[model samples]
Target: MLRTIAMGVLVGSAILLTLIVFRKKLGWAWLSLFGTHLILAALGIYIVNFSGLLTEIYIPLNPATIGAVTVLGLPGVIMLLGLKITLF
Candidate 1:
């Protein structure tokens, strides 16, 4: 139930943001935002690895991971961590 709610909220927010971006004719701004989010996500993963919290697990840097984090922001990172915990 909680996961479903979270996903619903995430999806709604993404749609809202997309609409706002499109309405303002700021398509390029979305690209910049995505780039920023990707960098933040990469930094977040790096920090997590460096901190040694999940010593035996590592999140790889790749397109799928980047895209998820870019689109969903911090919640996406939390989701990734949750998956890591559950899967491994």
Candidate 2:
């Protein structure tokens, strides 16, 4: 139940953020926002990787990973971490 709630929150946030990005910006502005988002997501991944030393949970910096983090922000990276822990 808790995990379900968290997942729902993540999805809602992603949708809200995505809508804001599309609604308030256009053309190159949104592109810059996307680039910024990608950078932040990459940083989040690195932080996770760094923490992984103790937790044994690391997310690889690949296109799929990047895309998920880029699109979904922190929640997406978190979901990846959860997926890793649950599956691997």
Candidate 3:
């Protein structure tokens, strides 16, 4: 409960800060980038799943993984694969 509330507050603060920092100049650009990242990440995951190359490993669809991929792009997917291979 408390942890959830704190996380919510933290996320809210980050959004507020981004809005303030970007204002109207780059807000749309940022949103578009985020959308592109999301689409690319989803597509990458889908392709990997469809190919069945890594049948032994599975990457869970979740916000953290999505966010990591969003921020890191293809490299992010490679990193996740590496982690999956080494960790599990």
Candidate 4:
């Protein structure tokens, strides 16, 4: 699980870094994406690294995490799509 998460994060960071590097050409839309990524990344890092606190605040292995991930992931996905759409 940890290894999987690590691989996912590595891939995500690489993608985000690409966006960040191209933000100048991407323009204002990239700013929105950067903000969304920041929020989701921070929240995800905290939740994954501090599962005990998250479990205490919410529930362990519950739908809330899944829901949050889904919601948060959408923006990043949109950003990636936007990057592709704009660049391609």
Which candidate number would show the highest lDDT if scored against the true structure? 2
Query: What is candidate 4's CA lDDT for residue 6?
Result: 100
Model 3 residue runs over 4 Å out of place are: 1-24
- TM-score pick, better of 1 and 2: 2
Better of 2 and 4 by TM-score: 2
Point out the worst 10-residue segment of candidate 2 by lDDT: 21-30
Best by TM-score: 3
TM-score of each: 0.61, 0.65, 0.71, 0.29
> Which regions of candidate 4 deviate over 4 angstroms?
1-27, 53-88
Candidate with more favorable, higher lDDT: 1 or 2: 2
Candidate 4 global CA lDDT score: 0.58
Instruction: Quickly count the clashes in candidate 2.
Output: 0
lDDT of 2 by residue, 2-88 (tens): 999999999999999888877877546767888899899999999988865647777899999999999899899889988999999
lDDT by residue for model 3 (29-48), tens? 77788898899998877676
Q: Ranking by TM-score, best first? A: 3, 2, 1, 4
Q: What C-alpha lDDT does candidate 3 achieve relative to the native structure?
A: 0.85
